[model samples]
Target: MKGTETKAPGVPQALVDLVGDHFLEAARYLREIQDAYPKEFVSVAKKLKVGRRKAYELVRIDRRFHDLGIAPERLRQIGWTKLAHLASHVDADNVEKWLALAETVTAHELKMLLRGTVIDPETRAVVLYLDKVQYGIFETALLTAGAIKDSGCLLNREAALTRLLDGVVVE
Candidate 1:
């Protein structure tokens, strides 16, 4: 992905220049500086108030492939968890195939596909990248469904999802 392209049309050139892999490059440069003078990073972190992990994430995200096969815009849409998660499982030759599958499923769903030792494809699963309030609503919905069922069995994630998709089917 050395000369990889990003889907950043319509974005300001200045902002685009500042972010993306270039951002990673900058982070790498900073890490190098810190390596040269270890105490300097402490000052930089204190001034910016960024933790060691935040700085390391930049390096990690940078040291990774120049591109994980998905365009930058698609990456923005899917988020890093999915990209990094899938990238770890597939070799360079199969990265694109897995990434294509990633677009068809939520990041969480993709995780399930990659990591779930036994996935029941007959029973579909839905995964959402929801914010705190949104997750609260989802949790409430699951609880409500369980309360309504009242079958002396707990409403686990699958059962709740099945109830939600009772009349909905995807080909």
Candidate 2:
């Protein structure tokens, strides 16, 4: 499914410049992955021992599937062979399986998978890791990190959630 309409607002331009296009792709991919394996996503994130924030970071940079340049619809037709090609760039561990599952899902199924799954027991940490490892720190993470840097304080899940929910207005 496409991402939720919940755009992150108030992001700084510098952060956007730092992250670039990859960030957007990563965010999109994360939504897709989550759609494919709602329970598995949470389980894997827990297994990886990453918190919600760190999980987000990891998934963001983990763009093996998106980088393949295959159309979402085409993914289902080609299946694992296609996904395997995409998985080459990112870590091969769990992605192979995730991509395979993604191939079986429809856009509407993906959307349903993400609904009510955005925030949960392990979501915050998983999202953070996804952002860091998979997508890399993009505008959202950079702005968040910068805010913390300026304040001389670290922001936790509650803080990040608040800002994210508030919406990061793209300039």
Candidate 3:
């Protein structure tokens, strides 16, 4: 998000400059690749020596800066994790405020503020119908992932139920 222009504290200025250039170039190339082939984003990511997740973050940084109201130079300095976290909050009016707040807090504190207990397991639940095979596979996967009971077993329905999303974050 576009905020007041200033270099971030405690990082080498040279690295900040490099990040701005690199993210811009990467975003430009990724946009071209996506536009030309549409389905080759994965291949583009592989060629760039970055994971799909990191590639997505870079593109988001590039393409959404205007929408997110973030300056490219500011974007380069905040790093990917905070940038991605801020994505949900930034908008034309609040971008400046968010950036100001980010600067005042540690990265961890900024994250905690933005996260804000929305994903607390105690406050969430889901009910769904899984087909027999889907249920079976889900159960097996959970067992392998150690979500099963201490006795090493789960009811058919409980397999996917036991922390199905316990440590898994879909976003």
Find the candidate with the highest lDDT and give its number: 3
- Name the candidate that leads on TM-score: 3
**Per-residue lDDT of 52-72 in model 1, one digit per residue for the tens?**
656555445444544444455
Q: Tell me the spans in candidate 3 whose CA falls farther than 4 Å from its real position.
A: 1-21, 67-70, 117-171
What is the C-alpha lDDT profile of model 3 across 1-171, one tens digit per residue?
A: 455443322323443344444665666566556656556777666666668877777677556564554566676676566766676687777878877877776565677678683333344336659999997887678776656455545634344555566657666
TM per prediction: 0.41, 0.21, 0.51
Off by over 4 Å in 1: 1-58, 67-70, 120-171
Ranking by TM-score: 3, 1, 2
- Output the TM-score of candidate 3: 0.51
Clashing pairs in 3: 1-69, 1-70, 2-69, 2-70, 2-71
Location of the lowest summed lDDT over 10 successive residues in candidate 2? 116-125
* Candidate 2, residue 140: how far the Cα is off, in Å: 26
Q: Residue 87, candidate 1: how far off, in angstroms? A: 3.4
lDDT pick, better of 2 and 3: 3
